[model samples]
Target: MDTPGPRRLAGRVWIVPGDPDPENIRGSVAVVADDSGSVVVDAGQSPAHAREIQSAIRAAGLPPARWLVYTHHHWDHVWGACAWPDVEIVGHVSGQEILRREAARPWSHRYLRDEVRANPRLGPSFRARALAMQGWDDFTILPPGRTFTDELTLPTGVRLRHVGGAHAPDSTVALVPDSKVALLGDCFYPPPAHLRAPDDGPDLAMVRDLLSDDYEWYVDSHGEPTTLEQARRLVST
Candidate 1:
């Protein structure tokens, strides 16, 4: 399938939808741009994925990304950091340890294969899918250079808050108030298949709090854009 291009969500916000492919589980990449430049949320899964987003940015006439803000420290969300060497990287303070560990590890398919074999949390079938991916020949994982504890606002008007949830404790939600949109990057979802137990879901209070923002649309990293009312109903149930 030809990868889809970024789609405008609101005012100056656009989202490059995440691919649900098991072999390539990439999270959505969001761009919020103004005269200052663009702030990208989530670096994507690989160099190829980051390049795809960059291409979209150019085609849309948006300024080059000035900052790459992470929603969490998951590999699929932050591994493409190498692609934005010049862009400032920002993430939750808690992610520092995790990213440090990941950056120290070897990234070859062979190492990853062994990792999956020994790490049950990675899932039983992940080894096969990891090996099946295009190529691990060219990739790098860089830890965020800047970290925030609670909330942060970029000079360009993008706001980020660490809203830890069951999906991932470091998960964050990005708000583009001017655009009236919330980029809830996996923060409202249940734990991933490998980590999920029968009763797992996002923390109701945390998810509900996101609704308090004056956003007209909510964009979950793995799902379609939803209306505020629709998003409210989702967390309420």
Candidate 2:
């Protein structure tokens, strides 16, 4: 994969794109560096992907990540935390609730198997992911040891806010105030048809309000980073 450059703003920022799929499920991770140390947003697609992302961050001149944050509760976004056994994880309380619920119900590969059996079109991709998640039975749910309800200020000067977005209920976005860059995890992706019943998604009005933010660079999880104008346009899509 051609690694993207470390696009700098106020502080150093790097976007590590992961395994892209037509479904746009493979989420990317953001690595931010300030004077204090490094901060990684979201894990990657898997454990191995998480490790590779760490190497890429080092190559970009950032120090080891002092924090690992989750954008939401989706498996594709949070599964990589397995690689960072000791990093202090940070995220929204909603995510912890979802993980704990799922852990108690013990949601696992069987759900995907049933999904694939119901929709034959999903067989190949689901099988591939299952194989990639070979040790998923041993996959431990790593809830954020530190969680916030609305917003919190990090020691590194980065600010995190819980933004109930279109994609998931517990989405969080990080702002590097000095640089005017905002790392938006999977906070705004359009959900699949299956998840559109109650149509739980980012409130467009709220997104419009958030877009009015002074952030120049808006980074999304599944694709390339965009300008404030481009992100504002996406609020319509």
Candidate 3:
């Protein structure tokens, strides 16, 4: 049988793990379902795996994904988006531009040197992990069919709000008011290191503001479900 998938967060919200090895950088995709149908938050690495995500949704009693919201322009996030054909793809306006730029550049040298080469203090195995996480050579850029800045609420009642920037340029977080859950993309990771300087933004404060008392639970692109208290500690430290 296939490896057991990631666990569910709340009703209709499932967190699926992507290549979880050190190099691959623990990436997780979230799935949400409602009367309007199902929507996937950030597609994972492999197209085949993304189809599996669609399968998981169907098994969970939701329709095939009606929409895909890309958190940012990262290859791991958008690589599998094509698996959901005909859906209205959405992303930040700047994210679209980044995708275009990546597509135009040669694949072998996609990421900045600093990103690919980490400090040894991070670990002796850091280089291997960095290479594995930089799985962008085969990525194909798919421009978002719909792009927005500031904030946009979907007809399904889920709100897409730009949380300044954290993990990547033009990164945005998705908030589900009814579920009291927020898809934090890559903004906030759990303790030890609550916030890291984002590729584009300063720190995790933007993510913290979005998670302020309004949201009870948070689903990050990585790590387990988090809470407002955890986010608060993260921001404070």
lDDT of 1 by residue, 211-236 (tens): 86588998887778999888788777
Predicted model with the maximum lDDT: 1
Q: What tens digits encode model 2's per-residue C-alpha lDDT throughout 18-66?
A: 5566443566778777656688888875676677787777787787888
lDDT of 3: 0.68
TM-score of each model, in listed order: 0.90, 0.82, 0.76
Give the candidate number with the greatest TM-score. 1
Residue pairs clashing, model 2: 10-179, 165-202, 166-201, 166-202
Report how far residue 221 has shifted in candidate 3, in Å. 0.9
Ranking by lDDT: 1, 2, 3
TM-score of 1: 0.90
Worst 10 residues of 2 by lDDT: 1-10
Candidate 3, superposed: residue stretches over 4 Å from native:
1-3, 105-139, 188-202
Candidate 2 residues lying further than 4 Å off, grouped into runs, are: 1-10, 104-111, 118-128, 197-203, 233-237
How do the residues 1-237 of candidate 3 rate in per-residue lDDT, one tens digit apiece? 132354677656767765546465537788777666667888765565566777766666665677899887766677677667768889989888778876675444333345436443433223433353336544565778899988988887778987644356667888887777889787543221223433434356665567567677877775667787886776777
